[model samples]
Target chain A: DTAVSQTPKYLVTQMGNDKSIKCEQNLGHDTMYWYKQDSKKFLKIMFSYNNKELIINETVPNRFSPKSPDKAHLNLHINSLELGDSAVYFCASSPRTSGRAQETQYFGPGTRLLVL
Target chain B: DQQVKQNSPSLSVQEGRISILNCDYTNSMFDYFLWYKKYPAEGPTFLISISSIKDKNEDGRFTVFLNKSAKHLSLHIVPSQPGDSAVYFCAAPCGGNKLTFGGGTRVLVKP
Candidate 1:
C-alpha cells in the first residue's frame, strides 16, 4: 500500500475555478505538510498540520487553505485559482518524533495542477 | 532571502566514480543540515543529514560532510551508479520548526 496518496494525479482547470487536492497517509504520522514546486523547481512549504492543528503557514496567498479532519489527512483547497497557481503540489507526512527537519519525510506522488 | 543555496545547477559523473554535491547556507543559526534525493514526478526523499556540531555523517555509499566555518556542506556518493541520477536538495532548520531548502542540483550518472 502507498504510504501517502493524493487524488487527481493531474488537475486542469480554468481561472477563477475552485479546486481541492486531497491527501492521506497510512504511516500513522502525527504531522502532514503541503509544498508547492514552481516551474524553476524551487519548493516552498505552504502549510503544516500537526495532529490536525495548524502549525506552519508560510507567506502563501490567502486563497490557499489547508484542512485536516483527522491526523491522517491534510487537504489543500484553492479558491479563484489564477495562472500563477499552476504548479506541482506535493503532500508529505512525518511523525512528530522525526526530530525536526532531520527526520525523514515521506512524500506522495504529487499532483500537477494547471490553471488556464 | 534564500537561506540555503545549491550554486551548481547540475553535475555529471561516470559510473563507479565519486559524485560530490555542494551546498552553502547563509544562516549560521542553522545547526542541522540534510540532503534529499528526488526523482521526477515524485516528492523529495531524505538521503542523509548532519548537525553543525559534527563534521561528517555517512550511510552506506552516501556520506554527508558539514563545514560550519564556511557555512557549507556536501553529499558524496562513492562509486556512483546510474540509479543515483536525480535531483539533490539541501535543507537546514533555522531553529526546530521547519526546513529551508535550496534550489537543488541535478546529478547525472553516465554509464
Candidate 2:
C-alpha cells in the first residue's frame, strides 16, 4: 500500500488556466507540505500545514494556495498558471513530534505539471 | 538565498565501493538533518537522519555524519550496488513542518 498518494500523476494545462492537485496520506501524519521541483531540479518548499493549520508559507505567489480539509489530505490550487509553473509538484507528510522536529517526511509520487 | 547546498551535481561509483554524498547548510537554526533517496518517476524516500546533538548516525550500511561547526553533513553508503543508483537529497527543517532541501546529487552505481 502506498503511504502517500497523489492524483493526476500528469497534468498538462494552458497558460492563464487554473488547476488543482490532490494529495492524501494514510500514515496519519499531523503535518503536510507542498514542494516544487523546477527544471533545474531544485526542490523548494512552497507551503506547509500542521493539523490543517497554516504553519509555514514560503515565498510562493498569491496565485498558489494550499488547502488541508483535514489531517490526511492537502490539496494545492494554482490560479492563472504560467509557463514558469511547469514543474513537478510534490506532496509530503510527516508526524509532528513534541518540541523538536525529528520526523522524516514521506513524499508522494509527484504531479508533473506542464503549462503549454 | 538557498540555505542548503549540494555542490556536487553527480557522482559515479563501482559496485562494492563506498559512495560519499556531501551537503552543506548555512542556517544554524536547523537542528535536525535527513538524507533522502529518489529513483526516476518516484518521489524521494527517507534514508537516514542525524540530530544536531549527535555528530554521527549509522543505520546498517548507511551512515550520516554531521559537523555542526562546518555546517556540513555527508552520507556514506558502503558497498554500493547498482540498485543504489538514484538521486540523493539533503534536507533540514527550516521550522515547523518546513524543510529546506538541497539541489540534489545524482549517484550512478555501476556493476
Candidate 3:
C-alpha cells in the first residue's frame, strides 16, 4: 500500500490562479509536513503539523497555507500563485516519538506545480 | 542560509564500484542525520540514517558515516548497481518537527 499519497501529480495554471494540493498518509503517523523542492533540487520545509497542531512554519509567504484536518491528512493551498510558485510540493509524515530527531519521515510522490 | 550542504551536485560511478556522497552541516545542534534517495517523478525515500552519538551506521550495501567534530556526513553505496542511480539528499533535524535538507547529489551508476 502507498504509505503517503498526494493528489494532482501535475498542475499547470495561469498566473494569479489559486490551487490546492492534498496529501494523505496511512502510516498512522502523528506529524505531517509540507515541503517545497525548487528547480535547484533544494528541498525546504514549509510547514509541519503535529497532531493537527501547527508546529513548524518556515519563512514561506502567506500565500501558501497548510491545513491538517486530522492526523492522517495535510493539505496545502496557494492563493494567487505566481511564477515563483513553480516547483514540486512534497508531503511527508513521521511517527511521533520521544526521540524526535531520530524519527524517519516518509514522503509522497509529490505534486509538480507550474504557474505561467 | 542553507544549513545542510551537499557540495557535489553529481557523481558518476561504474557498476559494482563504491559510490560515495558527502554532506556538510553548519548547525551544531543537529543530532540526527539521514540520507534519502529520490528518482524523477517520485518523492524521496529514506535509505539510511546515523545518529550524532555514533560515527557510522550500515544497512546492507548502504552505509552512513557521521563526523560530529567536523559536522560532516557521507553515504557510501558499495557495489552500486544501475538501479541505484538517483538523487541523494542528506538531511538533519532542524528543530521541533522540521528537517533541513541539502541541495542533493545526483548519482549516476554506469553499466
Put down candidate 3 lDDT per residue, A83-114, tens digits, no spaces. 99999999999998786433689999999999
Instruction: Report the C-alpha lDDT of model 1 over A1-116, residue by residue, as the tens digit.
Output: 99999997999999999999999999999889998999998877889888999989989999999999999999999999999999999999978775454256778989999999
TM-score of model 3's chain A: 0.96
What is the interface RMSD, in angstroms, for predicted model 3? 1.2
Q: List, residue by residue over B8-65, the lDDT tens digit for candidate 3.
A: 9999999999999999999998889989999999999999888888999999999999
lDDT (Cα atoms) of all candidates against the true structure: 0.90, 0.93, 0.93
lDDT tens string, model 1, B1-111?
A: 888999999999999999999999998888888889999988888889888779999999999999889999999999899999999999876544467789999999999
DockQ comparison, 1 vs 2, better candidate: 2
How does residue B28 of candidate 2 score in lDDT? 93
Off by over 4 Å in 1: A98-102
| After superposition, candidate 2 runs with Cα above 4 Å error | A99-102
Worst 10 residues of 1 chain A by lDDT: A96-105
Candidate 2 residue lDDT tens string, B7-79: 9999999999999999999999888998999999899999988999999999998999999999999999998
Question: How far does residue B11 in candidate 1 sit from its true spot (Å)?
Answer: 0.5
> Each candidate's TM vs. the true structure?
0.96, 0.96, 0.97
Query: What fraction of correct interface contacts does each candidate retain?
Result: 0.60, 0.76, 0.90
TM-score of chain A of each: 0.96, 0.96, 0.96
TM-score of 2: 0.96
Which stretches of model 3 miss by more than 4 angstroms? A100-102
